[model samples]
Target chain A: MTDVRVIEIKKSVFADNNEDAARLRSELKGRGTYLLNLMSSPGSGKTTTLIQLINRIKDKIKVAVMEADIDSDVDAIKIKDATGIESIQLHTGGMCHLDAEMTRQGLDNVSLDGTDLVILENVGNLVCPAEFDTGAVRNAMILSVPEGHDKPLKYPLMFSVCDLVIVNKIDVMPYFDFDLDKCSEYVHMRNPKARIIPICAKTGEGVDAVADWLLEEVYNWKH
Target chain B: MHELGIVFYIIRDVKQAAQENGVEHVNAVVMNIGEVSTIVPEYLTDCWRWAADKEEMLKGCELKINIIPAVTTCGDCGREYETVKYGKTCPHCNSANTWLLKGNEVEIKEIEV
Candidate 1:
């Protein structure tokens, strides 16, 4: 006789990831470490902006960058060459996204002792990265002006989950049809509490504002 | 793109659940996917077909996805509306003080043995 049964299990597929993220958050809180998950599209200038932000705030805070990619140490190399701060490269082994577990492992590999801020430059993809919480204190994303202003409607979830949205490459705003006001409106429509800043990473414009916000957030998290 | 990884996770969870319940084989697994989630259902199933077939317990098993509608609630006016339609602002009240009530879930809802 064959046995057949239907079991009703209401478990979140993200349950394990969420639990891991929560635990990571708690541990970081106890250690007074602020982790920021940075996400964006492939050509969003995340790396450049990160370098600028590090230059602005490295003097005030102990910062480390975890550069994640499908396969590359180029970002880690670049950050080390530019800022000389501790940087680690994470290869996802062909995975398009990094989850909480992976992020925790990366945290372990890096020397985070006495580290005030750990910035995870997540694999450049607006989709998969936003779906997983990497136990960061907050989530931020970079939206380059070349990516067009119609992104919010198409990728609402990414915009919805972010705490900060930086519009990069603003120096070329006159060249592109990217309307700052319209883009801000769209982002606000998706996330009312999200802070939107316009900047050009190439010229180092508005990078201080981003650093200021990061410092404030780190302070708030610690205190 | 990461659907294969998600499929692996689903298999791991299902296998664990089956072991806990002392089930011999899992016939199908059901997932609650949110409307705004990054997962694409078709790709998920496609990946499942490729990966699940390799596991003895999940061979020929079906993967079912239940999409949950994204909804947001207006704090000022206390009105609920479709998130995809109205986004952050409430269409009825035009309030920026709004939040997503549901629809960002990726969960295993059921297991058939």
Candidate 2:
């Protein structure tokens, strides 16, 4: 006599990354630090935002930054120069995104015991980062005015996947042909709950709101 | 593409599943890709072509992708609606008050091995 069996199977290709992100998430939460993954294009003012963020939030919060780039540690150096905070450059080599395993390694090198805010700056890419979860408590995206308001429509995944959206370069609105209302409409279309904060990272116009949000997240996470 | 790495993972999991099921070979892989997941189907297929050829059991297994539309429900009215392309706000009402109902998942639901 012979028997035939049917097997039920469910598998995930991102299992490895998921496990890494899960462990990393617990590690951050266990140590009482709010992790934010900041992602944007190459010239989308993420670094500038970091510089301004460091200037405002460093005194109020104990912060550490994990800067990811393709090759250079220039951004990390810039962050260090702006403030005396601990900054580590987490390079992804040639990879377009930062996965949970990479973020785990980055976190492993940092001390988040008394840290309040830890920001992981992902490589400057739109697509891949949206797909890979880095176990951040909040995934924030920076969209500059020059990148155009149509961005939310073009790269729906990047904008829709974010928890917070920083419409950077608002100060440039006067000089550039940017439509704030249209951009907001598109952003809300993709993610209705996404908090849209417009700012001019160049002139520090709306840095306070961002700092306030960061403080709130850290406060809520820690206390 | 991130799909290349994902393909490797799929191959590994399918191999284990086949071994446990006592199946000597895999015939097809059916996947449900989320619309807002930042995965390009073409790129994923291209990666699968190379990755699957590396495995003896999955050498010629057909790859099928079903794109799941990005959809959400309004928190205020509980009205489910299909996402209007890239813009996430509900079409019925211009309210930013929304929550993702489905369409951001990446999973390997079935494997014929």
Best by DockQ: 1
Clashing pairs in 1: A13-B107, A189-B88
**lDDT by residue (tens digit), candidate 2, A1-223:** 4353434565556776778788888878888988999999889999899889888988888999999997989989999888888999987777788888888889888887788888999999888898788999999999998889899888877887898899998887877889989998898877778988999898999888989988888898877
Note the Cα lDDT for every prediction shown.
Answer: 0.91, 0.83
Query: Could you give candidate 1's per-residue lDDT for residues B6-49 as a string of tens digits?
Result: 88888888999999999878998989999876778899999999
Summing lDDT over every window of 10 consecutive residues in candidate 1 chain A, give the lowest-scoring window: A1-10
**Which stretches of model 2 miss by more than 4 angstroms?**
A1-7, A12-20, B19-28, B34-37, B54-62, B66-105
Residue-wise C-alpha lDDT for candidate 1, range A81-188, written one tens digit per residue: 999999999999988889999999999998878899999999999888887899999999999999988788778879988999999999888888889889988888
